[model samples]
Target: MAGLHLAQLNIGRLRYEVGDPRMAEFIDNLAFVNDLAERSPGFVWRYEDDSGSAIETRPFASDPRMAINLSVWDSVEALERFVWQTVHKRFYGRRHEWFERMDERYFVMWWVPAEHRPTVQEAVERLRHLRQHGPSDHAFGWESLPAAQLWKSARCA
Candidate 1:
């Protein structure tokens, strides 16, 4: 059988103020959304820790605003639709209202085969790749998704 790979999506948010009310609402709903996605179409596996809760500042976790979650899915389209075409879309639209208004530096998507849930360290590297290179065969985003099918990452980004 073909090897399995799971596409991983990672995102982060910078906080101007930590205890803002809107920030609370964003956090609340973000968890709910992740919960919903875990059960939705093409869902396979996701990061054990919620992306919204984890933050660190170091070479690997250099961005204080950065957070992480990764999942293994059956197909890239399955993952993309779940991100842009669902309640998750609302979160995407309102990032500016809640977080810093930076051009898409905080979120990134890339492919891995099944059974491979990436760690925070791996997720950070993938985000770096997408920033260094636009969407390509190795690193990509939702807009650059391949045709409808599964993917197996010979190597993780």
Candidate 2:
């Protein structure tokens, strides 16, 4: 617990191209939401490009519309508070307006050294592991809360 951090990666497919008028609202609010995260209590670090936005960094090259978000937090509660108790909740509730519905898992959480900054490729592999093998100490999600806790216990032991 003293030397670890929680890392999260979430991916989504856009309903339209970045320049499309329909995506204007989401695009405009991106900076605001990202800023909120940086100012939040448990914020550690977030992946950003030269434009200060990760939207254009398409890790999934096969889908140009896919967007990825990777960040580190002090704890799960910190991330949850920022997500559910902030303006982000509003935009998240309206995700259907901008992102397509994916039957597969698109979000993942894992543990790493406190000083470690996870890379896109590493996060992608964890996500893939979760999608293919389900939740484990390797990677988990909100739906698999127990696995998240399991890692902490294992580490302590």
Q: Highest TM-score, which number? A: 2
Q: Estimate each model's TM-score.
A: 0.73, 0.91
Over 48-135, each residue of candidate 1 has an lDDT whose tens digit, in order, gives 6424434332324446555555677777667666766688777766766766655665556665655667776777777777788877
- Poorly placed runs, candidate 2 (over 4 Å): 146-157
Model 2 has an lDDT value of 0.86
Question: Which pairs clash in the backbone of model 1?
Answer: 4-113, 4-114, 5-112, 5-113, 5-114, 6-112, 6-113, 113-153
lDDT, candidates in the order shown: 0.62, 0.86
Which 10-residue span in candidate 2 carries the lowest summed lDDT?
148-157
Kindly list the per-residue Cα lDDT of model 2 for residues 47-149, writing each as its tens digit. 9977698988999878999998899999877887777778987888799899998889888999899999999999999999999999999998875564334
C-alpha RMSD in Å of predicted model 2 compared with the true structure:
5.5
